[model samples]
Target: MDQSYKKIEKLKGEKLIEKLFSEGKSVVAYPLRLVYLKTNFDAPVKIKAGVSVSKRNFKKAVDRNRIKRLMREAYRLNKSNYFNNIPDQYAFMILYIGKTKTDFETVTKKMNTLMDAFLKQQSLPKP
Candidate 1:
């Protein structure tokens, strides 16, 4: 796997986003929360991710963009940790939920923890 966040790996399109929100399940590790849903969209990669920051918390575009940048970089670097074991395709939305800005180290640490939680979640049989 390339392990890079390519344009094709970006989760977009109106219909797809709507379906994800409506059908996805979520896992959280403070400052970050991941909502993911199994996808049927044709694609080269097994996963596609979207990052978000609350507009209410970060009113400036710059602030939101900065946080998203950090989140993406963290995910990109550590994605391989659980990427190979994903048995199926999934679209993911990662949300930043902190009331204040946090450093890259904190975000990266939380991102790893979040992915671990997600992998563990996927391992258990669905109810």
Candidate 2:
């Protein structure tokens, strides 16, 4: 399990992002929200993920960028544990919804909780 977050694993494209928000399901854990959509990719990867920090909340590019960086690092460190066994490819957008700044420890803890919630939701029988 490679812990590095490579450029190829970064989610991109405007249309795909729009579709993800409009059609995807989300799981929230405090400041973090994981919005996921099952989708096929030409690339040979199990997941493509992106992180976001709201400009409205942070009001500064530096603040937003820092939060995004924290979120991405948390995801990169924790993803393999949660996603390694899954066979389907997914697109994930992790949004930081809190108003204040947070530390890496808090982000990592919340990320673990968020991923647990996501996996629990995934295992449920769909109606």
What Cα-based lDDT does every candidate model obtain? 0.89, 0.91
How many clashes (backbone N, Cα, C below 3 Å) per candidate?
A: 0, 0
Lowest summed lDDT across 10 adjacent residues in model 2 is found at 118-127
**Stretches > 4 Å off in candidate 1:** 124-127
Candidate 2 per-residue C-alpha lDDT over 51-114 given as tens digits, one digit per residue, 9 for 90 to 100: 9988889898999999889998999998878888886899999999999999999999999999
Inter-residue clash pairs, candidate 1: none
Residue 94 error, candidate 1, Å: 0.3
Considering every candidate listed, which one attains the maximal lDDT?
2
TM-score of each predicted structure versus truth: 0.93, 0.95
Residue 110 lDDT in candidate 1: 99
Cα error, candidate 2, residue 58 (Å): 0.6
